[model samples]
Target: MAALNLTPSDTSTFMLMGIPGLEAAHIWISIPFSMFYMISLLGNFMVLFVVGKEQTLHQPMYLLICMLALTDIGTSTSIVPKALCIFWLNLKGITVCACLTQMFLLHTVTAMHSAILVTMAFDRYIAICNPLRYATVLTNVRIAKLGLVGLIRAILFVLPLPLLLTRLPFCANRIILHNPFCDHMAVLKLSCGDTTFDGIYGLVVSFIIIGSDLMLIALSYGLIIRAVLRISSKTAHQKPLNTCTAHICVILISYTPFLFTALTYRFGQGIAPHVHIILADLNFLVPPMLNPIIYGVKTKELRDKVGKYTSRR
Candidate 1:
């Protein structure tokens, strides 16, 4: 392995190896990857369409669903297309600028996705624990404001990542990224310069943003459960709990794989690179692909609206 001793420049490009040990199986692996991406696109678009076209679906919860759908689309779109190109077309060259841009979009949208889930948990909390104040608390204007704040927060935290990477010197010989997409850590690992600050900054950002969001979500659900348990009738318990079912499913799908991938990357020294890469890919693919399905199946109003629209079409 010859080291070219290169720095980040306008002309520097990185080669993406689709999967470290599965180059021979790249085309076969792409079959399911493409399917997941397509399902994510179609399902999330359906959610957006149903939410937008129906006046009855224009509540705070459904509006949040719209935001989730948009983020889901953004998340999948940011990584999957490039991945498919790497897998199928064997076109792996990515310029530094393009790689940084993709990294930014991927991280930003992912952060926003986490924020939206926290907001949804808050919605559930208000609707259950403080039913009387739900409407006033989560008005359309306020939701819009929340979305804006989430976007700004995501940008603030993730904007420095690519910028920080620009300062690190990348080795020309080490430009081939083993993963499908340009991840912050993967790119950082390629740097020959000191990465202590970059690594610490990334870990801090993840803990601050994702860690706090998870804690808030847990608190919201805890309160919701407490409120539900105090109900005297078993039948009444079903309704409020039912409303949270899809959200719980979405959260599980989104976070479980994410935590696994992150942990594997940091601590699983014995784990194979392909295993880590596959889990990381699934973390982005599974949640978006399943979110709309979960909501559609669990929420009666959304299901009815979707059914009606499809029947009419």
Candidate 2:
């Protein structure tokens, strides 16, 4: 299948017919997506209820998990319902304002989502590397502050992308986004204005949110591994090291596809729209659907806590 290469300005709307014979693919994708919606919402909502109800789980790590769960919920909320709506129902018309709103929140939430994961890594790192100071460092007040910082980072990172897009002159071709929701670079390309500034902004924000977060997560682990090696008790050290396993897995699951989509959308538009569409759709949907389940399945404490909590009711 050849890629559809329409910019946001050039094609106001994307018809399902553009992709040749694969219309059934959208239906197939919808089945998995609807299943994801149930699990993603239920799983994250359970985490919120558990952490909120249990004071024993009030530590920094659980606090961070709560935040991650919320992001998982929010990220899924930002993209999936709309995508499902378009895919299953064949509803494709989106106004310029509506599209930009989707793009803005999608970028902001995703950027913040990654930032919080990086912060969670740092929290785990500190808990492992410097046990005595963990309580002092990651106070409830501090966690709240970090939450604030994450929001600020999202706003700062994603604001420019849409702001640049708004300035562009929209030609009359605005129709439907081929995918369910807004694709930032995909939508941005449709602009009649010079998108150089938006492109530059997107790159800078990518490096800031994606690149910086990746480095921070790595550095935190480096310090963590060093501290883990110094512990004398096998049992004592094992528990701390085990706590980090979930964060590490979440980072891999969340970031790799994220960076892939961002890079591809920015750099790979010339390739084919079909390829870009897959990357873009997977980017928003997978993290939300998978992260909570992965954390629940992998982390014993979370599993036991959630299990006990569920059974009690």
Candidate 3:
């Protein structure tokens, strides 16, 4: 156990526990982790590039997708690079400032990802519930404003986290993190001083930011379902419902791992440490890798554009 030192030290750094109890397998493990990183980068960048170049994709839904692609890139980029450095170069030490930056970026981007999903649900709601006014409701300027709001919301809510952490003194005894990347709760747990406020704030932020977004998304879908139910024509109902499949799939892939890991952290008493670490890592990795694939396969416009771009190259 480490003791708390409130004063700043000349040499202070946290050692990352890259797959604890599996140090020997770090080199081999890097292979798949690196593959996921590469694929996430390539896939998300392709979405951004293709959406930008293709004029036909300049619609509200795809525009929201562009926002999703950007958020995925931000979220994955925050974690994977440092993880690869740890695996390849055996560099497990991260400075205090760098660790705080990582935590901020990762959490903020995650909140933004959730926020974007809410907006996408709203987009779908309009398209299905009120198709005739979808254009008027979600205009280019309005879409941009919505994206800004999501970004601002994430930044505002997550801003206090680091400041709060900075006030606490870290234990000099042992700063080894069990996870590959820096997470809010993981870092707070290492502090030697009082962390009750930090923990409470963390829970409050998660609930207020992500919890509210989840409710709004559910409400949007509920309204959408009710509207669809009213449609007597089976073909008409199916058409609008099909438009939401991609977004729904993206939501599931993004949230399921996150919620599972969170629950395990809170309630899992007998779980192995490595399992917790792996889930935390995957919570960041899986969504970015799958978002593009899901959208490309389920969305006709994105699929056609991707095919067209790849064929030309």
Candidate 4:
């Protein structure tokens, strides 16, 4: 890699890569990617539209669903369109500022999505374990506050990432990123400067945010499980557990690919670059496409409303 003097300027641009080994199949590869993006948009938008139109669905749980839907839309929009452009049109030149902005939006929206999941877990816990105080605990104002806090927390944690990247002088000859989007680690690797602090900060922030949120969600479910088990009636246990099924599915889909990709990056050096890139892409792609579908299948009210709308259409 030849070193060239480059700073974060308008002329500095990074070339985004599609699947490294599958460059020949970029067009073929985009078929499903495009489908997933479209499905994510349509499904999440339908969720928001349904929630908005039906006054009866304006409860804490549905409101949280709306939040998740918005974040899902954000997550998909932040990355997929650019990815599709690279895949289909071969338009891969992204300026340093644009790449940094994309990186920031990608991470912030992801953090917000994780927080929404935590909020949903809390919602389930309250509805099941503290049924009497559910309404009092999670009013519309409170939900709005929670969403605001999630946004602020996301911005606070992710705001420094682009700033950190800006300080690192990138190798002028090595501006081609091997992934579809401007990922934090991918961008960090391009920097010629000592990235020890930046890398450590990124990891620490990720652990603190993801680890703490996971723990909170686990604790919430643990309590919910304990509360359900204390019930004397076996038949009564099903309803509470059923409500959580959709959320659990969402959590698995949202986190599983992310954890797998993170672990692969640290441990799986032999993994193909294309494979890693695909997994990384799927981390952002899969959840938004599946979340609403899972909820529609598992949630009766949402399913009924969707059915009514489709039948009428």
User: To one decimal, what is the Cα RMSD in angstroms of model 4 from the true structure?
Assistant: 3.4
Model 4: residues with Cα > 4 Å off, grouped in runs = 1-11
Candidate 4 residue lDDT tens string, 1-313: 1112333232578877777889889998999999999999999999999989999999889999999999999998999888888888777678789899999999999999999999999999999999999989999889989999999999999999999999888876545545888878889988889999999999998998999999999999999999999999999999999989999999999988889998998899999888888988888889999999999999999999989998999
Q: Backbone collision count in every prediction?
A: 0, 8, 0, 0
lDDT, model 4: 0.89
lDDT of 3 at 65: 90
lDDT of each: 0.89, 0.75, 0.87, 0.89
Candidate number that wins on TM-score, 2 or 3: 3
Window of ten residues with lowest summed lDDT in model 3: 1-10
User: What TM-score does structure 4 among the candidates reach?
Assistant: 0.95
Regions of model 2 farther than 4 Å from truth: 1-21, 175-178, 232-237, 262-275
Question: 1-313, model 1: which lDDT tens digit per residue?
Answer: 1112333342578767779889899999999999999999999999999999999888889999999999999999999999998887777778788889999999999999999999999999999999999889999889988998999999999999999999988875545545799989878888889999999999999999999999999999999999999999999999999889999999999998888887787899999888888888888888999999999999999999999988998
User: What digit string (tens of lDDT, one per residue) describes model 3 on residues 1-313?
Assistant: 1312222232567777688977788889888888988898899999999999998888878888999999999988898888887788777777788888999999999998998999999999998888899889999789889999989988999989998999898876445557888888878987889999889999999999878998999999999999999999988888999999999999898888989988898899799888888888888888899999999999998999999989999
- How much does each candidate deviate from the true structure in C-alpha RMSD? 3.2, 4.6, 3.6, 3.4
